[model samples]
Target chain A: MAEQPPESARTLIEVVPALGEVAPLRPGDPVRVVIRFPLGHYRVPLYLRGKTGTVERLVTPAIDNEEEGFGRNAGDRRYYYRIVFPMTEIWTDYAGPPHDNLRIEVFETWLESARHA
Target chain B: MHEHGPGESRPHDEITETGPPDYFDVLETALEELLTERNLIRPGEVRHQIDVLDSRTPALGAKVIARAWVDAEFRARLLADGRGTCEELGITFYDDTGLIVLENTATVHNLVVCTLCSCYPRPVLGLPPDWYKQKPYRARAVVEPRALLAEFGTIIPDEVEIRVTDSTSALRFLVLPRRPEGTDDFTEEQLAALVTRDAMIGVVPVTAGKDGSGA
Candidate 1:
């Protein structure tokens, strides 16, 4: 239960941002999540570390999770993408249908080009 | 603050069955007290926020879904802009979090989960159910969605592809379940009554009988 102050001075409806400024990693591009674990609060799930996935769509500009978790203002805006991973890729013994997939919203900083790996 | 080693259980065995206050509970109270003491936030702001959340329920989401089911134009608007559409129905999302409405089609099913934490669309669907925040639901929803859906009695056809969306703090998701059959003559109010929080969450589908009985 989080409460934000009323936006009396603001516009009635906030404009939703469109997909803007495609970076090196575009939708459908293969990418790998960084394996490093930083201290303090983080949004990247431990299970996704070192996993590769395809970018489904660009979601929004990255509002640094670490900064926000620490009660600080959002830092450098990076592109966040909706990445989809095959269940088999995430789990070695995935017993479900082969077509099943998992999609997660990941920030750019946590990803790297999967061309080499 | 004391930090427990990895995989170490909390030393609550010696305490009473009720045990001590949760560690995170103590931390949250301390943080709130500090913020209030410094005048950074009002004394009762936290309680006020909790009250605001408690005031919300699945009925609000049911109203939105009912409107969409009856009105094609409203359904289009809801698919395009979820927050704006909700606002049109007098439901304002005060927070900056963006709401995305996922539609369930005949061949496709959508399930939402937050593997990292419980990040739900509070404005529309209200607070999440207790099971949604648990680790089993969070971990299994993305990995074995069909099996998970079966546990909820939502048996999807083998041909239908199940799509799982992992929600985050920045973006929240609400599943726009397909309109149930045998309800063409039912009023919008009746349709709303048929809609449940679980239906909106995509774990179950809304069903109604011709006699307006519960499904």
Candidate 2:
């Protein structure tokens, strides 16, 4: 039999408290993707670079993809967010209805305030 | 028992020597053997975990969907806490990855894809299909969700907005397909039978026959 999680595991809703240097990005905040070409394994996709999107939700505080990918103990973690962008904004030739959108989970380091962009 | 004499070839030996050894296969074997030799992990435990994974299928997800359809409160629970709610039906999520269920509605359609690596809701939906892990799906699902979905034979209407979610992190997503129109009178088991693996993946919708039989 598969081992059952303890009764305390019933609390499935993850409540990530603000701590450390976590960004103040909240749900519904418009953010622009940072244009960075870091040399190493990274989670941010190439297409999303410099694109603008709204934060959908705060997912969790996770170790940076660089550390996770390279098995290094960089001792750094960032708040991950689910960001939603219009499909039209993502692809220039996107031939879809105007309301179509794409949601991507991204780390805090890849995002910046879109207000000035 | 037939024994291979000197200079004699066996059928199994020929098959083994024909192809180059896969890199991942060699790595996995070496790792497993090393761990077992170091008493870090038992081979039996590894086999048991594999068996657990092998036993999981889309049927388990279908059962959860069926129950959610018949029971309103269960649906609420399922939407609120997908991982915990699945455990109510004896479906355990062994991995720490969290599951979020997205509902398909009249005005909205939901499609899931992993743009990076294949981060799937394997606990509820079993292993992802080959196409789901392919480059075409990972690339196209994000840029042109509607076109990608249409290729899977799911044509969303113009009025309905399609939302494509890229599971890029620890969070995995599953689409809770809208229940078929005529399944109100059907039993949960029959309803479950109508819920195909593709339906849960949001590539298709559930359908029921007029005679109360599932399609």
Candidate 3:
């Protein structure tokens, strides 16, 4: 039943480093996964799109997985962050405790600084 | 698991030699011999590592959790860094994958899932369970963690928060289940026995039952 991942997920290849310099987001920074459904390779979950969360941990820079079809295993690198989002923020009918939340690693290319910066 | 190794002979052992053709057995033998001929991995080393992988189970993770429960300093080190801390306890990681230990407390209960793929802490918990990698579990774990936990016979009170962690990156997650009460006088080994695979995976909490079974 692992059917949630888009068809692009099956098309992803190896990792590749980006050729650029950028500041990595630190823990406690608010961020949101880019809300887009572009076809091809991407790691951001569909349910997490447009959702906001705080950076729980600053993971090391990782290779860009969005080769789509070309430049795979040779794309620019991006920093990864462990983003924590409340369940209430993810679903309208979240029935658990209000404090319940979700955490997932998101690439810099798939994320943007959220409001309340 | 009921199968025995080494000198123990099974009833079908004699017939197995001339029985059905196995693809993996031939492939593994060829690969191992070629690697050995190229001065790469030795056959003995390969056999030893096979044993290591086969022997690795949730017990290894359970032991680590038990140690964390008894020793504050070790627990702190485990929280700060999972790989180095496990290595400190003499647990060797076969690969470079990082292990991130998520602590469970009275306020928060942690659950782990790999929504995109079945990325798991194999070094600590061996292979991921079949259900963990399946599509339904992956799809629902994060969306309805409380419901999923309830399906697993775990009822988390409303006061306790549930933290669903999706292991989407290279680093894998292992839930450090809360230590059960009434075990203060229990030995470290006894505590380890009570810690089950489901508890370490955060689907359930560790219980203090004498009939400790299941991986």
DockQ of each candidate relative to the true complex: 0.44, 0.64, 0.61
In angstroms and one decimal each, the interface RMSD of every candidate reads: 1.6, 0.9, 0.8
Better of 1 and 2 by DockQ: 2
What lDDT does candidate 2 reach at residue A73? 46
Model 1 agreement with the true structure over B146-182: per-residue lDDT tens digits: 8899999999887777778888658888889988887
Which residue pairs collide, candidate 3? A1-B135, A2-B135, A17-A76, A17-A77, A18-A76, A18-A77
Better of 1 and 2 by lDDT: 2
Two-chain complex of model 2, DockQ on C-alpha atoms against the true structure:
0.64
- Residues A19-116, candidate 2: write the lDDT tens digits: 53456899989999999998868888898999999998888687787678877645656789899999888888888888999888888888899976
TM-score of chain B of each: 0.84, 0.87, 0.80
**Which candidate has the highest DockQ of all?**
2
Off by over 4 Å in 2: A1-23, A72-76, B1-27
TM-score of 3: 0.78
**Candidate 3: C-alpha RMSD after superposition:** 10.8
* Number of the top-ranking candidate, with lDDT as the measure: 2
lDDT of 2 by residue, B1-215 (tens): 33332223444753475688667655766777788878898646676777778878999999998998899999999988888899999998888788888888899899888888898889988899999899999888887777778898889998999998888888888788999886677898998898888888788888787677785
